[model samples]
Target: MRRGAICAAGLLVALLLPAPAPAREAEPRRAPEPNTLVPAGAVRYAPSGFPDRIVATPAEDPSSGFAVAWRTGATVDTPWLEIVEAGDSPDMGAPRRIRATTRALTTENGAAHHHRADVAGLEADTLYAWRVQGGGTWSPWRQLRTAAAADAPLTLLYFGDTQNKNASLTTRVSLEALRHAPDARLALYAGDLVSGGDGEDDDEWGEWFDATAALRSLLMVAPAAGNHEHFEQFEDTPRERRVLGAHWPATFALPGNGAPGAEQTTWWFDFQDVRVVVLDGTSALDMGTARAQAAWLDGVLAGAASRWTIALIHQPMFSPRQDRDNALLREHLLPVLERRRVDLVLQGHDHVYGRRGGLRAGQATPQYVVSVAGAKQYRLSDAARDTMAPVAEDTQLFQVLRIDGDALHYEARTATGRLYDAFSLHRAAGGARRIEEHTGDRIGQRDCPRAATLKGRTDRCWE
Candidate 1:
């Protein structure tokens, strides 16, 4: 028989065969769901106990590397890595495994842990598989693809706040974003990855990680510190000590280059042709520390050599929610960004979705946006008329960003993958930023949940 005929006949035979026995089922059972909060005296460590967090290093070196992080109940036994080309395969399947060494360390939380297995020796624009070893057991292999090394067009994933109902619906959004933009080089989270403050329970953060498991293989996260990350001050605590509770550095190994006085809270690094600068708005807004990080922002922006400069922080200067505007950020950081002509600014905390024309210091650079992911919803204020674009309310959305040569394209997608807003920024040889808007046919509309339609009210309107 011909090759095509034989292939068809083989498929027919497979279909004609009796169904496999129930005992031969291959679907693996889901991970155990831990109690939301540990009992008063239980161990209460990381619920999933898997190597939980992974982030991409924004290095411009030949040895492109991504940092993989996981917390275990006990010391990991020789954390190893397995790698293979990411391709069409079963959810769990055989892959080539390689041994990678692990280091041990301890944190203030009384958890003796291991760190530093920086996965190096990776090819640019190539997909690689990896996993961690917790003693005799092994973790599901994670897949990661490095960004393109040279100056070329690239794509990335941007999310606002994945803080509310994070475990349930938020994971859907993150997975969908990855599903839609699988090759996204990096995923940027503009703060509020969780709900609690510095004394955060590891389990809460685990939910955030769970929401993004499907993309964990290819997506390396870069997270900012949102207001929710700040701890409330006790009476006797010193002012500086009360600001941030030091949990951030313990969790992720971020670039150490931050504002002079704000080293631990602020940072900036370049990736390919873009320089990403992150600041702790809680410090800048709470106790008048804006000047210090603002100075650092100015210096970083002025020294940037990348074609595009983007700033990611928490609070928004052009918030659509009345209760959450950041007057201090507008006064401090905006000037530095304008002076340096930064291309994009991504912020969250308002729980609403907004994309506005750029503001030099207080006036309107090229593009500024405040958005939200997860289930939290907020009502849009009347200030929508003051901006160039529309202000979205009662919406949970994610953004897919594309950088093609001299232009950048942004599309805001609803939780279910509907495009609600679209815009672009163009960079000319030497000039001010030019902004253009697109009204695509992919628009969607969602209204506030009616009382009868509501499930249960915790806080916001979407309840």
Candidate 2:
């Protein structure tokens, strides 16, 4: 009788409670915004009558000559370049006008003309101001200095892939690097300058140019072709293939003394005491130019007369990612590097920072470095973590190389201009090389935890 009375009381309490609220419907899912590096309502990259995208490239003999390339509207044909020795007077001196070789190109952004001028017989280590003419107007004079004829102290800037977020992230890194080494003689880029190479992403090229506009006009650029520089052709078919993008040839006037088929992509130049050899790893891997480029590298290194030899390529021989090992590069190019005893190998495509002193023990001739200068970051492979010392991930970096006498000093700096790694390679008079690490006081390695799922999503560690 007591239990029944208790149950009746509970039923009366439940009946008095308000009815349960109806289930709230899920809000409609919003579509994700477009993934674009360009900002809203940004100025279009369309070419005007005035010249744009001006750049200076090292000549085969940089001591006496250099090449300049620019872009203008398609209608602005018959453009020319004017050069004068920089002097203290505002009146300046008489300028020498050189006719430009213009090539008409039709890109996804419409039609434009690319002009190249080869200015030769300039004084060594002398500064010259030059400009290009388009539609009867002259571009602002840009200054470039010739390489010294003899071996001397020099400074150079090296950057990995500036492939993504070029306008914002890359611009900061590039400008910071310029601030750190404003007088860098030559800037070496390890390819993948832009993320897209499908011929439709012309704006990316413009962003790349804008990011490095200051440096390009001031220093010589030596760049190699990364895989991303190749454009897809005959898409969605078995006959589909990759070809070198048209913008590459239109952008920089590289020394055309490379492999026969890959002349524009692979080349070498002498800048003071350093011999900068740029190889087309993309072609070597995809286009079956491995043996040819390897042979060329061997011959170039064998006949190198410079005090220092530096090789620039896109693919890393010792990849920071275990799955990214390039057997083709290792088989064809590694032997050439080891046999030639190249002093330094600067590479990209790993999207991580790794420095390997030598392939074997008690050897320090070749120092392999893979770095990135873009927003993209990759997780270091387990093998890289175990073997590659002083490594970093989730960091954008640039390297400054200063060569004084027999010693080469290298410092890797973050986007904020903080030194992250440092080292020095000293070459003895007897031809032996030694490496000294200066990374003791550098900031700790930047890394992040691997994603927990196959979708590859993780929080950004750089922030």
Candidate 3:
């Protein structure tokens, strides 16, 4: 009788209890494996199982998509990405999973692995929190915000060759770029991210990546391949020469709409209202590739319905350095730029600051610029002054390009935050564009302050 009473009480308790909620399905984790890569030498350059050198780059379409490339130790075979729409509250739901494509780059330096994920189908102007998984380990969630719709205002930070001494350099410029234009959405790196093509994996690249980690984490870089990006190992010839660096292709995955031979290296993509074309100047100039690129450029410019088109290249159409005239660029590329009425042209490799442009007959547009962002400085020649006004020397500068409807303001500032040069481009009737120069101290005279002693300092330029 007592047993029957106890069973009746249990049944009564069950009837009084609340209904159970469905449990959420948990995300799957990768199985762990032992890491065996050694640390003694550069060989098997798998530094760590954790991801390093993570960079977020713009896909062909910035408003809808973006890409992430990162390196990790070889132990993690199948790296993947977990991304979710970032929310204000901490109780966000499970993220969507996207698999990564792995490229095994085996260099004499070591065996390094590069993994890239092109995230698409994203909402415009939405913030996302994403993290990568290297085997069982996971990186901290990093946040990225997609670009706004087609008609939004565009702002970009422009910089020149950050080639050699990069690890010790470039970061300051990157910070300065943010300091000047914090709302800057992207950076135009005029190629030569490293000094030499040491191998698939090298120290210079490590330094370059590490130093720029802070800025690249926030901004997507549109990089072109400068001369230093190419290197070749010729067993047949005793003389050693550099060809396109091995890391160039793997490191940067730009848009694939460039010339015939130059694919990602020379490409064009439109963000907001601006169309940015990054050309492979080194390949086009020396390797008889200019014609194809010019043809490709014409098509790109013709098809681009954007309000503004800007061309970015490593070699200058109008050379700042006396010895460095890009005749091929002038003959092949200049006509297309002029015909397309491109608003601005950004170039590097002269290691000096120069700009030349004005309203010309029949509406020839596109102002030319060559600037240096690193500590390496070159002298401004007298002949360049005829074409370029307010030419600067021994200066490291960062340029901010702001594009709004009907007007674009361009400002070039020194590393120490001095306005070195400024100009404005106004879109006129039909398709013609006009330039309005910004007036300031004009330009400080480039007088070589000769070996005058300054406050116990020997052999310095007297300001």
Candidate 4:
């Protein structure tokens, strides 16, 4: 037979074999117990006793390190993690098993547990797989790609408030944002990741984790603690005060480089030429974290070596509501931020969509934004209108940031991927910054229809 005829026969023979179907993921995890407060069958990805709420928060140096946190049943103690470098082959060979630090967390639902573990000395720009184990059961494998080398362009997704709506309902915004940017390195939660204060409201957190658990499993999250996630008084003991939510600390493994008293709650980390600093404004204004956080903020910015520096907080220094203002943040934190000349600030609390490049000493210094991801919406009252030109009202939005050496491009999109606002910060030759606005097709503002009620449920009109 000729060569062509022989090759054709082999191809015909291979076609006789069947291709295998892909493996299916297990039932998505859910809340351990029902949250009766929320109506039955409202909106939720129920939590399971098995490993749930998997998340990786950026470590001090995200280039070669990362950390994960998860939850399990109280009965399952001694949480553990198994990790390995992934390969093209189907079987992932012997993974290194490391035991995690477990803590018992009793919530409104019932008694459950949370676990966390930090992995360091990882290879830069590598791919790895990890899963947790409890009660002799292991979670499905999830893969993570480490940060690229310094000087490389970086991209990340930013979210405002995911509070007030069903945990699952609000989660769609994050998943939607992630779907739009397949190459996003990390996700930023600018506070109010969950509703219900003092961490006693466990059901809501379950919604948050279950809604975006799959996405969070792979990407590192640079998060800030929001006011709704903390409170000075708890219902259990009205007289006593809690610095942060009961479940906040046990939820994620964040960086340790923070103020003397604020560790993971308020910390800073470096990732691919970008320095991210998370500040606890709740603690700063109400408690005694102002001076300390301010001092630490100045020090961090003073010694910052990254090309871009960004601050993430819960409350905005420039309030969008006429009734409210973060006076302490303005008086203490703003001075340091101005002095340091931080590039961008991401914040929540006002639940309105607004941005500004307020002038300082006759030059555009920093870009500040207050956005919301969940269904709750608030009308923008000025957003420091004198400083912000194109402000918005009653919107649910997310932001995506792209960073290179000289410019940082930002886009604010609605939950359904509608671009409402955009801007680019260009660095001039001698430390001067210029802002360019890009307001694409947008609904601009949302209004309550004649017969609509957003009192308890997430408003679907925005979506």
Candidate 5:
């Protein structure tokens, strides 16, 4: 059976299985086999590196400022940036090195080391080489293209979810996205980065990061927290509030523009012409921070100056899944987005792909997207048409967006890079909006077709 089928089956098993025995361990204790590959020959030229969760450097203007964050197994008290502009000629001489370090952070997930070095003092709209290094060996030099000075034209990659078996199949999707857009300015992850929360023992995060090393070399990652990142109740508090034990905050340097309590991951950043807002859907709905985040979000929207606005988070305020529409968030967030004329709202949680339109206050259409990027799969409801433009069930997918002038082109490509759906949102000089959807190769009404059965798998949800 196909991997998706197996995943579907596994999920079904979980639902069908008897309640867990009282002896079940609170934390799973499976350690992945160590990876010991020495870079040699052609391997030395590969983009893969030692540090896991390797992510790109993001600057206010990507062409001018460049920053990157990486994690190491051991402590690196001091970390720095080694960067230089590569000339047209091969002999670009040596790079100029700048040093910096992060306050050491050790979590229950693992011994963690993180550093963010912003390389300034450079030309605009240029390609530069850079990497991160600590006390030990410096990372292999990687290339990055800086952002344009102002209103620069660029392409940004957006993905739905990569929250499954990180080691085997999830990597393929992430690697494929990087391969498709090696020079993409930045990447937006719409949450569900891992399958579990503070119980950091879940191996999916490690696997997801391990597979996206090459793409991480030049991409800045902006991730939102999905429901899957939530953990069950622990002690008197929930796991989501318990430091979020995984490498969440340390893995990425997100803008801290959220409410008082949830500041690190929930923030907004401007990429020249676009204002990107990230929210913690988990916190909004379950953490009692909805009122706070919603209040702050309204303020941010009211004061925004960017020409275009985009918000990314985990749960879909609108989904094709039955009873999955986040009414609370919709009540709080949708009005602000509509009032702000938000261009795009990217989200993932329903494990399906959908794009709805004709959005208004009470009876809204599917103008937002809910996608899945892992081995997991879910079924779409027939009523999805009420809220979803096009829904894809039981398929792993990613979205690539290209911004050129007033036209924002969006293509929802599957894991295999198939342009399953395409559309363009044109922002006219008159401040009017026009949406065009292409139906030539459209994958009709998504449903989980009869899939081959995985022999020994206990999960059947994906099938």
Candidate 6:
């Protein structure tokens, strides 16, 4: 047969064949079971003869000294820390050993002891290497720099809640923030570092420590207390009482100079040109310590000697979530903050990002910011959406603040190290403060589909 005729006959016969059926849709995967205990193959973070969760915190006067705290097994009855001034040579010259103040702490996992050592009388702006000894074993030497005695330029890293998914999600943001500001003198956490606040959830605390291990060891930590840091006294009690979690006291060695009743959670310290005042917002709201805290706050700010004052509280002055409002805080603490003219206020607990300039017109002294650095996110309230500029939802954020003489620069960056918002506050010797917003070529605000508007609702807002 001819080639063309043969080909045409074969094509016509093939065209008559039946089409193949579509592949069956894959079955939907079942959700995994929820487990509160440490996952398999994960580090248990059980206390041992060696020190772990070693954290460095600012002393009442950071220029003069700093404090270090660590966790050890109960078997280590007498723990101590050794310190030496860092020099060019490798050998540490004649280290000084200081006895640690050890406190017995019992968690769900096991009994442990937390040891704190105050390394005092150190030279200002000097580098020092220190390590902790539990029993006969010692921790690796870690280096830290003391704050300058004078009003020198400084950098600070501010973080919001790392409450949920610390090891898996929040760790990246925390590490990236440190990489972005390698010279930061202090890291101020707004609060709710761990999800479980009952103080018995050692695993959650382990995750938090894992996320900021390097930060705690390298720089000073100033943490505020959030509502999650408070545990209910009795379940379903009519008088619903809350108390500060036990872990808070054992986790960090903060300055003792705070409000009379809430010393551990409320404290202040001076680092170079700025004064950081950490308030126990949870205590004030739940434990009836608002009036006392307010009085203490006013007194603390009244005698402020630093050129700048920054306040850290867990609850937002201006809430970003519609369902939440801190009327008690606004009533008791807002006045003190305004009257004291706090330069900056960093807060958390709404699971969203918000920044509001001063309430008064032509004034920029008190800038309010609420940010979240964890995976959990919330829907933005209408009021926040309308009033707050550069607000964000479903976004993890970290802030870097630099103070140089009369000018302070602030930058808020996302988890991926992208600048989301920025502003600069400058003051003239006796003149009013001025703020300039950096609104040029920044990333757009992030928002997820509203729950009410979605066709099929999921467990999370973003989903």
Question: Which lDDT values do the candidates have, in the order given?
Answer: 0.69, 0.86, 0.76, 0.77, 0.69, 0.86
Q: Give the lowest summed-lDDT range of ten residues in model 5.
A: 36-45
- lDDT at 385, model 5: 59
Q: Which stretches of candidate 2 lie over 4 Å from their true place?
A: 1-43, 197-200, 449-463
lDDT of each residue in 315-419, candidate 6, tens digit only: 998998868898999999999998888989999998889988767876787999999998777778999998888899888999999999888999999999999
Candidate 1 or 4, higher TM-score? 4
lDDT string, candidate 5, 1-463, tens digits:
9999999999999999898668755776445322212212212112122444556645544446755667664556556777888677767878888775564455444455676665677787678877677446677777777667456677888888777665566677887787777657778888877676433432445556776666676666777877776554465654424335445666666545566667865887677677788888778777777778878887877777766778888887776775566888888877777776777889888877887764655322225778888777766766785656677777888778888778787888788887777888877776667777788976656567635324323223362
Cα TM-score of candidate 6: 0.91
Candidate 5, residue 400: Cα displacement in angstroms equals 1.3
Best by TM-score: 6
Question: RMSD of candidate 5 to the true fold?
Answer: 13.0
Q: What lDDT is obtained when candidate 6 is compared to the true structure?
A: 0.86
lDDT score at residue 96, model 4, on the 0-100 scale = 84
Candidate 6 C-alpha error for residue 59, in Å: 0.6
Task: Rank the models by TM-score, top first.
Answer: 6, 2, 4, 3, 5, 1
Query: Against the correct fold, how does model 3 do in TM-score?
Result: 0.83
RMSD of each: 14.3, 5.8, 21.7, 15.4, 13.0, 3.6
Task: Estimate TM-scores for all models.
Answer: 0.78, 0.89, 0.83, 0.84, 0.80, 0.91
For model 6, what is the error of residue 455's alpha carbon versus the real structure, in angstroms, after optimal superposition? 15
**Candidate 6 local lDDT, residue 343:** 88
